[model samples]
Target chain A: MNNHDRFVTDTAADIAAIARTEGWLVPPAPIGRIALRPWQQAVFWGLRIYIGIMLVIMGLGFFHVAGG
Target chain B: MSAETDILAPAEADRITYTEELEARLHDRLRIQRLRSAPRGLANRLALGLALIGPGLLVMLGDNDAGGVITYAQTGATYGFSLFIPLMIPLGFIAYLVQEMTIRLGAVTRRGHAEMIWKRYGAFWGAFSLIDLVVANILTLMTEFIGIRVASAIFHIPYLVTIPLAFAFIVGILVFLKYYTWERISLFVAAFNLVFVPLALFSHPDWGAIGRTFTGSGWALPGGLFSAGFLILVSANIGTTIAPWQLFFQQSCVVDKGLLPRDIAASRRDLMLGVIGMVAVAISIIVISGQYLHDLPNAASLGDHSVLAGIGSRLGHGAMVIFALGLLEAGMIASIVITASTAWAIGEALDVPRSVNISPRRSLYFYAPAILGTAIAAGVLMLPHVPVGFLNLTVQVIATVFMPAAMLFLLMLLNDRELLGEHVNSPIRNVLSVGVMVMLIVCNGLYGIATVFPHAL
Candidate 1:
């Protein structure tokens, strides 16, 4: 429950019912953790390579700006 | 638990709801949800839209920061009523289209940008992204202080006095205010960004000349678009228009403001308003300088203090003061929003409780980064002869350089069928998003070559 504020009271369940009747869930579901998929690491590495190149070029360009 | 056939008994109704710890964010969000079921009328609809509108407006306006103001000013001063004016309109639409994805991601997923990146992509990219965001934020914050410092100087206030004073106000509001209160105060300050609209009119910009830019003549750059300065300025323009922090900030803001999927359309309208404000302010700043400083011998290199002084000399001290005040407001609002973005990204990535409602007493960790980060940025501002104009433009360029990574992560998240369900990016959006990514890379690369070669362009 570290990520959740756990509380229980059947009284608000009546109030929650009102929201449910209106096509809403009073307390919505959380977007919890997910298992990393197969292609994710590949994609992340590709991102790293692209960013690494951009960073190097940008660093040089910025250095030129600073120096000149 | 089924409701009784009639109203609840007095004894049962007396029981307090959510006794363990009803988070302020959740409580506030639920209150807005109640407003959604209000009777259909213009007033009620307007109220609901206003309540759900913070994240997009904050992100778009927050981007028209110290760097943005200076970059737009420099564009007008250097190129004068060129393609840049018409360019800003399309850029605004592109910004809207790009940022609109974050609304669905945040609303449907109910997770912050950093949290999604961390959980979905794993901790390495998350930590890297967090670091990049914090460092960029600090550098960007220093540029903000420069804006403040320059504005203060216009009024004869020293940096020693103004920088820390602004810092105190920033930290004070952050440590004290809750989400709704803090957001409203920020919005009020953001309204001053429109000061540029009047400044544009005050500059007496030629309507014919401005309109003719849409014709072929305005498309031509004086130094040619390939020139080093022109390329860098163009890249800076792109950088300012669609920044990385914007992606992180808006989504996290949407999550923090507790926007549900039901509120996405309203949030899109909010984003459109933001796009309009952002483009208008940018064009106004460009026109203000285009009217006065464009023909100056050193217009391209005027920087903050000199540009205002240049306008003051022509348009009187009133215009100078107005421009400086706009910069001051822009810097201040961007500083506040950026600080929150940094803290929120850190908190979410690290799994600390992240909300504006987290009192400093309960979790000093939440507010510590903001205070320390601003302190460091302000400390940098205090140093002698910090080439802040170049620094500001450099911050924008840096934003352009690493923008691909930010966009990549965002695109991936938005396309996540598991999380966004029916809200995933459409085929057309995919094409546009990829095009934008490529455009960012090309802009950065072209600037790089131009920077090194100097005369190559």
Candidate 2:
């Protein structure tokens, strides 16, 4: 088998072993997709606003220097 | 059916599916295997502890990069150890708090900070953060190269030789070595940073006076504390200790090291040790510079290269050589880390293969950005009469603009219960994180104003 295929098989076995040891009924798998909750989206927007204000301040500083 | 048969046999035997959870479990297995085989004794515990200590120690030493060393030296020469020595204590705490969150996040989530941000915050913020981190990292890498040039020149080594040598050394390790080997080599380079501590002893600084400065009026500024120059130095020191790249670097490093939740206490001990070493080396530089160069004319104006030469003249040539070696190692070690961080962040953001364990052929996209950054920085330094001072100022400005944004993301991530579960920020942690975030914002604002309106400061 190729290296990538072998890596996958080995990783699957390893995860299975760990899940069994920890008494997890179902073994965890790789995250195929990520969808944030509503609260997370709100926090994300808050960050965007913070970054936007910072950019504006930076622009003003640029203009102040230019006008001088 | 056996667990392995149930999980692995039914999975497509011909193809390997690589996922974040699977990768984390594989690391868990590796740690478990090591523990099973190691003999039970004090020696075994020591070995295990040594094995677990890389990410935190590397991050702290990486903070004392070439630019950071120069800043400390300038602090000592201009103001002496009175103000900044005491200042290092608080800075160390800040460093620990900021970095410890990364450890918990990495262990609990099993994802790098970049991947976590992307998964939770969506593409706009993820892309924005990636761009900011990459730009800052490349610019910072240039300063490291400039540092390499200055230290090499002290020994009369040409730029043509030093730049390429640095590139080869940095790229060779990443491309060929696995994570464990790469980390150990990097740690050895980091230990050289303590060369300053012994050199401090060589300077024969007045211990009684140094002690008095700690308790007596040393906290008071020689000139007014709010002077433009003092504020600029303070900003630089803050910029050096806490940085945008450090958050990305440490979180990714812990993930790469495969640390699990059970390893958290050992990791904290590792982090505290690193902080102590970092502060010791920083204060040592300040003390040595204060003793020998404090009274010299133009001491404040002299760059790090000249300062080293001046200190060498007074203390003897051997001291200068050791200083140059330390500077070289600082630049080299930080270049390895910064470049790797850039690579890891880009790889995770793009959903590409991103571990050091993958073959070069499979992980080309993962490794390319880092190699490209190192190459570009090395090329820039080889140009004739490069404006080193302007590059330094640009690094500080980029850091001032980017650090608060980085800290905000870290604080938000720490509070996310979905990501951290029981490991989410506690009340005290929340207060400390917010307090640090506010302090960084205020400091960066002052630095921003000073940069724009130099005369106003």
Candidate 3:
């Protein structure tokens, strides 16, 4: 068998064996997983960056308001 | 024929059992692993509940800043506590509606207010909201320091001396502590605000008068100026109870607290309890001031920062000391929370590294705002001609104006099906939210007109 097939076989067998020993059954891998698009991740973090600059500006404004 | 059929069925049976048992085992293993990582027995869940509670409680108490206390006190002294008590009834519900939305939005989105605005509305609206928030936050922070300075003057300390020290202490606490630790420390400080409640007892005002005021006599707004000023102060009182910063702060804190979607119910319960505590304490302040000081000629003048110096002479040194401590604690804790919220919003909006969890060097964006906020607020206090009252009034007006926009964003996020799925706000919540937004718009409109034409409304 090829290396990829052999590795899958070994891993599945190990999981199955462990399950049996622990009084459990081995389940199949999930069919789907969540994956954000590159652009989405970029948008999410970009929003965070804008908020940071505002906070710095707001904080400095305190000195002017404090009137020291 | 029977034996052959039995053999075929047995083969199929074995295949089915193997698949079913394997699936069960995998599920069990995953469950075990999760439990091992974070156990959810009674003890563990209770501990988590306690830990999750700090931010909600601190944010609510922070809402009851020193200005809030004095406003409530002045309301009582001026109106004798009748109308204000019932007003708090609706006010509490309003507080709940507004605050609960924040908890939901925060726990679900895992993004702060500024961040959401930046993403959804673009930079123009984002910058507008940020500018309003920053201006309002700085102004509010000034009021807190003013409370500190006024309270210090009661004890014969210079405002300058007290202001710097208070700033240093607030910065040191926020800088050294993470979110969890900062919350815990702030809660301890918030507890001191209960001093006002007991001070109510020391006043020994007629319980009968106080009760009658609530149940029978209407609030006295006979004159024109009194009526106008009363509405303004009422707006201020309610406005102070659930300002826009609270929406940003509490929600950001929820996300930072690592609350999952499953924790939404718990977080709401936490927020409701906080709203109750906040309104109860504020009413108590008003009640005390009304009962004891209503007969005095300059009762409303008690809110005057300059005249507040006579508090000790009137209330006895012991009572004054406790009141002063309460004032100091309220202002300082508010300064910390507001500053932190200011930092969190900026960081969240800009996608910069922020949070008390990260070290100062790594979290410069987070800590920088907090440091700058305190410094400038302290500096404002030192200035000779800062027009502190106008600044305070401007902050309230700004909050009143921007409130509708904040509420609009909140309502939109809460109704987002993609984000909330089945957890979106129900019909009743939707109606209540819309009603609140409408009321806020009216309040702001009237306020604007009144500002422009002092005699009209």
Interface RMSD of each: 6.4, 7.3, 14.3
Q: Taking the candidates in order, what DockQ does each have? A: 0.23, 0.16, 0.04
C-alpha lDDT of residue B415 in model 2: 86
What TM value does the first chain of each candidate achieve?
Answer: 0.49, 0.48, 0.44
What lDDT, from 0 to 1, does candidate 3 have? 0.65
Per-model TM values vs. the true structure: 0.90, 0.85, 0.76
Q: Tens-digit lDDT track for model 3 on B244-292?
A: 7888888877766645466677777777777777877787777766665
What value does the lDDT take at residue B43 in candidate 1? Answer: 90
Model 2 residue B387 CA deviation (Å) reads: 2.3
TM-score, structure 1 vs. true: 0.90
**What tens-digit string does per-residue lDDT give for candidate 1 at A1-68?**
11223223323534443333433345445555565566866765676776667667667765665666
lDDT by residue for model 1 (B308-341), tens: 8888998999988998999999899999998888
Q: Model 2, residue B333: displacement in angstroms? A: 0.9
Candidate 3 residue spans exceeding 4 A from truth: A1-68, B1-48, B224-226, B295-307, B384-394, B450-455
**lDDT: the better of candidates 2 and 3:** 2
**Candidate 2 CAPRI category:** incorrect
Cα misplacement distance, residue B313 of candidate 3 (Å): 3.9
Superposed Cα deviation of residue B360, candidate 3 (Å): 1.3
